[model samples]
Structures are given as C-alpha cells and as structure tokens.
Target: MERVTGVGGVFFKSKEPAALAAWYRDHLGLELEPGSEAVSVFRWSEPGTTTWSAFPEDTQYLGRAESRAMFNYRVKNLDRMLAQLRADAVFVDDRVEISKFGRFGWAIDPEGNRFELWEPADGL
Candidate 1:
C-alpha cells in the first residue's frame, strides 16, 4: 500500500488570523473567500489538488502543545496505512474520525510533530 500519495493541506497558527490572511491576499495574491470568523477556503484548480490554510496561534487543533504547524498528508487507505505504521512501531493516535468529508487519523513523528492523515471522500 502507498504510504502517502501527496499533501492534503498545510495548517499553521497566527495571532491575528484576519490580518495575516489579508497580508497573504495583498502580498501573496491569494484569492481568499470570506467565511465565518477569519476562515478562508482556497479550492484546488485540479480535481485532487492540495489545500493550504493557517490557523489561530491559540488553536489546539494541531495538538495540546505549542506546535507551530501541522501537515495533512493524503493517504490511499487511512486504516491500512495507520495499521502499517503501528506495525512498524510508529506511535499512531487511537482516534479515528469519519465524516462526510472523509476519514482522518494522526501520527507523531520522531521529532514529536503531530501530523494528520486524510483519506478523502469519494469524488472529492
């Protein structure tokens, strides 16, 4: 089984999400969409392209620690991939979540960076 197909998304934290997003838009020319709070969704030009976004500095979504960022890796089979990681003595998180979007899992790297694995929903 393929371990990681590609990058799904890149997430990081910011003290002022709105100001930071505006900076990206103005300086980087990212066409940001308006959403609740300071969230922005940058759709992929290709069907299965990747996503990139920045989170709030105080957000604990990455982990309970002060992780600067988290990378979401696209996986072929999330369950199987996680199983393989565990079999190889990797510290895979026990929590597996499924939603309309797709399945999600987490694993810690040797450096202790908490990263996410995503198996996208069909037709996504």
Candidate 2:
C-alpha cells in the first residue's frame, strides 16, 4: 500500500489577501512567493513532517465554525513566538498545551483565522 508523505501547502481565502500576506511577512517572517504578494512559501531547512488530521464536526479546536481548516506551523521556540505575537497586539489564545509530542500555541490572524504554532519535542 501507498501513503501520503506530507502536507503540500495550505490554501485559504482571505478578504484582504495582500494585506494579510504582508502581515504574515512582517509579523511571522514569512516570505512572499515570487511575483505574488498574496502567496507565501514557508520553507524550512530542518527535518520534520507535516501532519494531516481531521477533527470531529462539533469540535471547536479550529476556531470559527464556518472554517473548514487551520494551518499549523512548526517553530523553533514557542515562548518567543507567542511573546512576539502578543507584543504585536495580535490576538493570542491564553492557553498553551504541552504533550509528549511538543508544545503548542495559538493565535488569530488579522483575517480572524486561528492558526497554530508548534515546537516539537526533542527528536520529534
């Protein structure tokens, strides 16, 4: 049998796409994709895997009920990332979850999309 290797990319609709991309670029250090301000390429040099998952219909983990998906970004430091987001006055979830897999934090983008940040545990 064959299996999917990893998530290809995250595509979503934004009302102010260019502004949103710029926000991500300025705040999260994301780079704009070539010839496109509304698209970004989040390239990572480290070795890791992207997870594909689905939540129950009634689950609230993805924020707005109308939202069908959320983007999860892997980072080097959860604390520092969250702190910068907070200092930028972004809407960050008060809760941070720690598990054997890694540490997790969440924040709402300017477009009101809740996104996740993860700092993998050692060897993950």
Candidate 3:
C-alpha cells in the first residue's frame, strides 16, 4: 500500500569513465561496484535514496540550478499513483512508457523539481 517502495537507479553523466572513475576512487574513496571503466556503478546506501540518472549539463530534470542528481522512486502501481497525484493537484507528466523492465512516468514536485516514477514488472 506504500506509494513508493525504494529507489530504482541513480544516473550521472560520465564521459570517459576510464579517466573519471579514478577521480571518484582517489578523492571520494569509492571503488568500482559492479560495472567496468566503460560504465562505472557506485552502490551506496542512504535513507529513501537510490538510482542511475545522469542528465546533460543543459538539462534541468532533477532540480533547478543543477542539483547534480535525480532520483527515480519505485511505485507499486504507476497508473493508480499517478491518478492519486493528479487528484491531489500535483503535476504529473502526460506520457508513460512501458518496457520489459517496468512502466515509467514523471512528476514535478512543488519545489519545481522533476523526478521519475517506475512500477517494476514482475520479478524485475
């Protein structure tokens, strides 16, 4: 019955990860979690936080003034939750996409920040 269960993924723009990964490794004491240099994955734990959403510099999907990250919340039912949000007068994106992974949608918070909503398919 929860609106959101957990985070789905965290993404960031990492061009030339072979060189950039070393910086995160050396400075932040982070190590490669699963992916290789071509694409690095950093798995850390935080309260109600998770995902892999990297936006371009010109983009403002996460928040205004470049907040540096975006979060994708895991919902039980995308259609219902979106309807709830709509009834509550929250701004929900009109488009929804479905894939083998899940059904996805977007919503803007009161703070004018954009975030993602995902209803994972069975066993996903």
Candidate 4:
C-alpha cells in the first residue's frame, strides 16, 4: 500500500501576519511573501525525511503552560539559523539542548504561540 511521503504544508493562526511574514523572510529567509497563500510548504533537501514529536500543555516543551504547539524544520546549519534569528531580534529560547539528537530552538509567534526549530545531526 502507498503511504504518506512528507509534509505538504503548515497552517497556523497569526495576528500580525504582515509583520510575522516579514520576520520570517528577513530572519529565516523563508519564502513567505506578503499577500501570498496562508499555507507554507518547506521542501526537504534529502529524501525519506520524516519525524514524529509531541508536546504537552503545561510546562511541556516551550514556555507555554496552557497550550502546546511544536514544529520542526530540517535546517542545514543550526548555529547559523540561530544566529540569523538572533540577528533579526527574534525571541529565541535556548533553554533546551540535546547531545545526540539535534539542537533545539524556539520562538514565539506574533500571536504568542510557541514554535520549535530542529537541526538534526548528520545522517540522522
């Protein structure tokens, strides 16, 4: 039987969409142009890339204790990505770290929601 290959898009609610979209473009260099579609699709560089994750509602992963939301991005450079976000003045939470899995980073959206960024280890 045929199975799911990868994620098609990410849909999330935002309040200051214009600023948020611009932040994504300037900070992370994402392809989220202003006046574009609501859904954003990120293509994987390598094949057969799939991941599973879970978060809790209270003190789960991020600072949000009432709501839980997380997402991962396959980035080429973790340090560089973090640097970019920092340079853009994005609020990055660096309280979490791992040895073998990958680097974990986060930033709250304009609507006060938590989002995760993952830069997996080589050959992960």
Candidate 5:
C-alpha cells in the first residue's frame, strides 16, 4: 500500500476572498488563489509535539463550525512572525502561553477561523 505523503493544500471558503487572499499573501507570504476553490500552499515541517490532540465535537470555535481545523504550522522564529502580524493590524488574540511542550499563540483569519502558531520546545 502506498502511504500518503503530506498535505498538498488547504481549501476553504472566505467571505472577503480578495481581502483575505491579500492578507495571507502580505502577512504569511502564502500565495492564495482568490476564488471559491482558493488554496494557500506552504512548505510545512514535522510537528514539534508528538501527541496531537483534538477538540470535542460540541466545541463552539469558529474553525470547528467550518468542517475541521486542518493544519497547524510550526515556526522556529515565532516572535518575529507575530511581530509581522501585529504590524499588519491583524486580529491576533494576545493569549500566548508557554507550556512544558512549547510556545502557543492564536491568529484569526478574515473568515473568523482561529489558526494556531506554535514554537516547539527545544531538544524534542
């Protein structure tokens, strides 16, 4: 059996498609194709955390309502990325927390989906 390699792209619906595409392009440097079948592709790495967790079915989160929250990209320079997002006036929830695992922060897209930005603990 041929095993699946990795995620190719992430497709989602955006209310303000153009604006959102521009936001992703300007901030995250993701080249978003503006349309209903828009996808933002990026070169991702292995997750820092070994054990991946999932939210309950009855969750009240924005992303939860829209099918499933697909990807959580890991970053080595999270602070710098966060700074860039801040400069763009993007809506970032300032509830950053450092746990035994790694550092975590949240950023909501124009469509109100909460995406996680993680910086994993060293020597994992």
Candidate 6:
C-alpha cells in the first residue's frame, strides 16, 4: 500500500484572509473564486488532484499548530498509514474523522509540526 501519494493541500493561517487572497490573485495570478470567506479552493489540472486553501488565524480545523502552516498529504489508506507511523514510534494522534469529504488523521513530526493525512472521497 502506498502510504502517501501526493500533497493534497497546503494550509496556513492568515490574519487577513481576503487581503492575502487578493495579493495572491493580483501578484501570483491565482484565480480565486469570489465571495469565499475563509477558504478558496485551487483545483489541480490533473484528474484526482486535490484542492488547497487557507484558513483564518483562529480556525481550529488543523488542530493545535505550533507553526502557521500545515500540509495535507493524500494517502492510500489512513488506517494503515497511521498504523505504520505508530509502529515506527511516531507520535500519531488517536483521533480520526470521517466525513463526506474523506477520512482524516493527524500526526506530529519530530520537530513538532502537525500534518494531516487524507483519504479523499470517491471520485474526488
């Protein structure tokens, strides 16, 4: 089983999400969907490529983050991947969530950066 396939998303905190998004739009030319408050999805050109967005500074969606950014990695199997991490003595969180989007799990790196593991919903 492939543990991690590719990066699903790159998330970070922003004091002013709209202003930062506008900067990306004007400077980087990232076409952002209008009227999105906290998140703006950037879809990949390749099929099955996952989306990326930024969250508000106070958002708890990424759990406790010592850093301003987090990385979401696309996984083949969240359970197996987490199990492997635990077997290697990695600090894997016990909480796992399943939603319409997909299954999610979290792990802390040696340097204490939090990262997400995602098994995307079917056909996503």
Output the number of the lDDT-best candidate.
1
Find the candidate with the highest TM-score and give its number. Answer: 1
How are the candidates ranked when ordered by lDDT, highest leading?
A: 1, 6, 2, 3, 5, 4
Error of 5 at 5 (Å): 17
3 against 6, candidate with superior lDDT: 6
Cα lDDT, all candidates: 0.82, 0.71, 0.68, 0.53, 0.56, 0.81
Better of 2 and 4 by lDDT: 2
Model 1 Cα shift for residue 66 (angstroms): 2.3
lDDT of residue 96 for candidate 2:
98
RMSD to native for every prediction? 1.9, 13.2, 4.5, 13.7, 14.1, 2.0
Worst 10 residues of 4 by lDDT: 1-10
Candidate 1 segments exceeding 4 Å error: 34-46
Model 5 scores a C-alpha lDDT of 0.56
Shift of residue 118 alpha carbon in model 3, Å: 0.4
lDDT of 2 by residue, 10-122 (tens): 54555566777788779987777677766664444556645434344555777898776788777777888888888889999999999986888889999998888888777
If both were scored by TM-score, which would come out higher, candidate 4 or candidate 5?
4
Report the lDDT tens digits of candidate 6 across residue range 15-74: 898888778878887667666744556566765665557678897776675478889999
Worst ten in a row by lDDT for model 1: 34-43
**How close is every model to the real structure, measured as TM-score?**
0.88, 0.62, 0.66, 0.53, 0.52, 0.86
Q: Which regions of candidate 2 are displaced past 4 Å?
A: 1-46
**What clash count does candidate 4 reach?**
0
Stretches of model 5 off by over 4 angstroms after superposition? 1-52, 60-67
lDDT digits (tens) for residues 20-118 of candidate 4: 666766787666424463323343586424433222223355455555445555565666766787787888777657657566666776777776666
Cα displacement (Å) at residue 29, model 4: 35
Off-target runs (Cα >4 Å) in candidate 3 are 13-22, 25-50, 53-67
